[model samples]
Target chain A: MKNIRMKVARTEMDLSQEELAKQVGVSRQTIGLIELGKYNPSLNLCIAICKTLSKTLDDLFWED
Target chain B: MKSFFQRNKVKDERITNLQNKIYREIFLIVAAICVLSLIIKQLNHGYSEANIWTEAVILLVSSFYYMIRSTGLGIFSAEVELHNQASKRSMAFKNIVFGLLFGIGIGTFFGIRSAVLYADSTLQSIYYFLLVSLVSFIIYIPFLIVVVGITYLAAKKRSDRAVEKELEDDQDQDEHK
Candidate 1:
């Protein structure tokens, strides 16, 4: 349940969920959960994902 | 940046390692069951038959099980980062629930044991069972309160420390830039 910001950023970066999960060392399911809004990643994880995708935390994770 | 990510990734690995420690998990479950069995056996077989070694094993196993289980569960319960406010609150709630549930279980076991050992008839045993259970619940309430309070406070403090560290890291990164 990825937020729109995250999904859009990852897609724009040409990174699949699996690739992002691999970069961050989390399972695919965890990424999926985060995407689906079923789970929230920790600060470290959020930072990792943002780094891998070349996005800021606000760009990928900020909620309206 | 590499070092920062590596450090945090180490934290993640530590958690994943514990989650994957199946042998320890099995040992913990088995030891807990053994402790319960020992208590039950003592009630049924009488305290005179309770060997000191049995008590020793129960204590040792219980301490290990509790230490590992609580830490592991706390770390692995949610994937949220350790410093997050929600993570802290969630851990606090989890600790409280675990403590209360453990108290209830111990109380029920001891209550039933008391009833079984003292009562001569089945009906009397059943009545004693209920009475003792209620008494056990009452006895455990104060202890549960203390335990839950301490756990929540400790978790909150740790969360604060983690957040402080995160902020410090951010500052360091800004300085580097």
Candidate 2:
């Protein structure tokens, strides 16, 4: 499923996909794919994104 | 924006290096085959063959060219980095597995055919079958390795180009925004 939490947080922070991708050291397409649920980001990448967004893994990746 | 361009430039260089390596390697391999053919012809005293001198000259020239061309390339001079390593690795692994399976099928088919069609006795048939299988395996595995290796390099180049294009597009979009 799409990471709705990531979308919500990114929009909240007003960070574009490219900006987040750059901060996470991945291609924008990778970030887009992850957001769209077309690709699964690795655990390292998840952590990177969490760190960049100043959120915990449980907040962004974990589903209730 | 600037980082995207820089990353793509580095990736493009790596891909170009890989592409050149693939071409050089394949050229050398083909040249080697030609040389081997020439040597076998020479050993057999040009018997049952048409014009050994012509073949030898062609092979010699081509082999020299490939050797020189391959030497000109700076392969593995530095550690190569690939952005799409995971997908490329997965593709290469799949190609090798499929190539091996296909090779086995071909080897088995030829072994069975030779054993059944050309043998004088049951014992001779079994020996021929095993021999054929072993020889075919030896030949097929390397052949598949070369084929798959070239394919992997070509796929890598394509993906790298795609990434560059994507980065350029993203830059343009950002500038407009």
Instruction: Name the top DockQ candidate.
Output: 1
Tens-digit lDDT string for candidate 1 (B72-154): 43432223333233344665567667777877887798779978789999999888888888788788856886777686676
Over B1-177, each residue of candidate 2 has an lDDT whose tens digit, in order, gives: 476456533355557779999998987787687778777876776444574667667777875554344323311110112233325555556767888887888788789988988999999999999999889988997798778777556545655555444344232243123
Candidate closest to the true structure, highest TM-score = 1
What does candidate 1's lDDT look like per residue over A10-59, in tens digits?
Answer: 77877776567667877544565576665768889999999998989988
Candidate 2, pairs of clashing residues: none
Pick by lDDT: which candidate is best? Answer: 2
Measured with C-alpha atoms, the lDDT of residue B160 in candidate 1 is 42
TM-score of chain A of 2: 0.93
Chain A alone, TM-score per model: 0.90, 0.93
Q: Residue B130, candidate 2: how far off, in angstroms?
A: 1.0
lDDT of 2 by residue, A12-41 (tens): 777887677667766666776677676667
TM-score for predicted model 1 compared with the true structure: 0.45
